[model samples]
Target: VASWAMISNFIDVVKEGRGTFSIQGLGDPSGRGRMISFVKAPARGGDKEAKKPAIIAGTKTDLRRLSMGKAEAILKTLGVPAEEIKLLTRWNRINLIQRLSTAAAADGSKLGDRYGGFA
Candidate 1:
């Protein structure tokens, strides 16, 4: 439940349009970065939301694995620009993850300062 709350708080921050959860400098040789992203992806909703805890607690997925459907849902959720959404979604670029993950992680005040971004 703790992990769920932390992730949910992060999601709430992104939903508020306060900040973004970047992925540029987030990845690494270890896997904490992956944990953050792993948790972030499931937080998007639908069937994914239910398995958020297991996803975070269990195995880790590829750092660069994300579907087109997820891209559209994220762009729409985070309020990304309309024209750019198509291009970004088509390419499934890293910037989209950067903007999205940070958006998910930021919590307005401190998290906003540390992880908040839309670029």
Candidate 2:
């Protein structure tokens, strides 16, 4: 079982950072995989809010390499194992902002189909 401290640490790291990002997975039938890219979101709430947001574009590889790819790279850099990620099945949000906006376009360099069709 995972410890609460580990989970709390992950949350704290994300809270202190500012940016948009993505993680794409690709692999073959054997489950060997590679991740394309993990773009970070643009800096927000600063002196200039007009700057283009930071977004992870995509990289391509065989589906089999998905697990070993970009998403895994992110985890490795965070000193966590790839298998520790738990997929999100639902979302319930509470925010103070009354109106917010999300970027609708993904960078052309990224793959459209594999990563939720952001592009």
Full-model lDDT for every candidate: 0.50, 0.32
Model 1 per-residue lDDT tens digits across residues 13-112? 5766544444423312244555343122223334544444334223253324557766566566666776777776355655665656555666455433
TM-score of 1: 0.32
The numbered model that scores best in lDDT is 1
Judging by TM-score against the true structure, name the best candidate.
1
> Cα deviation in Å at residue 65, candidate 2?
20
